[model samples]
Target: MIDEVVMLRHGRTQYNLQHRLQGQIDVPLDIVGQWQADQSGYALASRFYWAKVNRLATHPESIAQPPAAAAERTDINQYCEAPAAARRMVVISSDLFRAQQTAHAFADLLGLEVTCDARLRERSFGQWEGLTREQIKAIDAEAYASWKRHTGGETRYGVESRAQVGERGAKAVRELIQDPRYADDETSTTMMLVGHGSWITATIANLLELDPDGMNALGGMRNACWCRLKVRHTINGQPADRPLFELEEYNKAPAIADSADWENGPADLRGSSMPDWCPIIW
Candidate 1:
């Protein structure tokens, strides 16, 4: 069974910077987004010893040399002593460019390949895809109001229902948990899913067997942020009862900011690009 599931939202993109709705558009990460992914990759490499091994394994000399070479090497040695069986790690990502770029950062650092899945893609906004919330309201007042109220199953241009997104997200989780390619007897296996904000939120809600609208109360997650959930499995490491998720962490960044930075919290540059039209609160 998978011991831990890490959900990472893709980093900033041009659309993200412009307050535009990205939906299923294949947008690449911008300069800041690239840096964010790199920093997040390094952080993950530090947290998971197996990922560290993968990071260091790229340099054969580092593996052969003694631990005294450098402080970083010393840190690597501290975690590399685990048995070979304990190092299993995998990265899965949405097929969207932003998500793929984020996954590639982790994959490059961890010396692993990325497995793309369509189910991990962001929920399509349909005709509302590129419009700002204000634009949507100006263009189709009824649809915009319906979405805000969560009362209608369809949007102005047939926007995806929350239930549809939840089902797709839930199916992806089920596939990962039950598919032999992802899960095994090894207890140390860690799976990382690189996806969009709405999709990740829905996936977590589904894993916990929450109702269709259950995630509304959780608020939006930030770009380049991640969350963790422990997976429960059968004795032999197979998929177990529903309620597969036990939340460990949610919407966390690698580093915490100083309290001084909170005086103008919403104005923080890191998330300043967030648009009011964007459903994500972060």
Candidate 2:
């Protein structure tokens, strides 16, 4: 079974820059988005290095306490090279261009192939797929209003609702758990899912049994950002039968500073507030 799941939203696209709804449109990543993918991939790869699980099975004493704490008892075989009981890594992506491109960056870093799945694709926005938000509002104000209210607008358009996306995504993951290729009691797996913002948010909300559509509920991930979950994070007993998860991180991107960061955007230089947040890492 998967112990830790890292769900990343695909990098930004031209549609993203124009504030357009690109649901399942197969758009590609823009320059900044590509840079973000590269940076985040490096950061994620470094996370495995720093965890020092690569030596867990052979030299478990090198790691203080239990190496399991760092891995959630999962196996990252290529990265960690642990025994059958160790952790392993798997990369999966939405069968969309944007998501595959993003997944490639991370997979290349890990020297792994990404498995694409249509179930992880963005919710089909149907006729509104290529339209900008403002354009949708102008074209059909009532439908937009219904959407904002988290009501049924799917009946009017060919759109897939949050519920549909959630169920499809959850089922895909459960099927993976039952698949012999990745799931076995001997190995804990660290799975990375590259997908669209809406799909990832809805899937995670469904797994946690929370409301993803509530006005103040789970928000969409920023382009190339990610959220981490402890899959069925249990203590004292075995993992849950369901695809349960506990939110560990959300809307998180690589904080590595570069010469290009904090440039051009007025929002970046407006003296941001930290909001009393404390992170485990300084």
Query: What local distance difference test score does each model get?
Result: 0.73, 0.73
Error of 2 at 23 (Å): 0.7
State model 1's lDDT: 0.73
* Total backbone collisions for each predicted model: 0, 9
- lDDT (Cα, 0-100) at 277 in candidate 1: 24
List TM-score per model, in order: 0.79, 0.77
lDDT of 2 by residue, 79-108 (tens): 345343256677889999989999988877
Give, for candidate 2, the lowest lDDT window spanning 10 residues.
273-282
Model 2 pairs whose backbones collide: 74-87, 74-188, 75-86, 75-87, 75-88, 75-188, 76-87, 76-88, 77-88
What candidate 1 gets wrong by more than 4 Å, as runs, is 54-85, 153-156, 212-216, 235-243, 256-282
- Top candidate when judged by TM-score against the true structure: 1
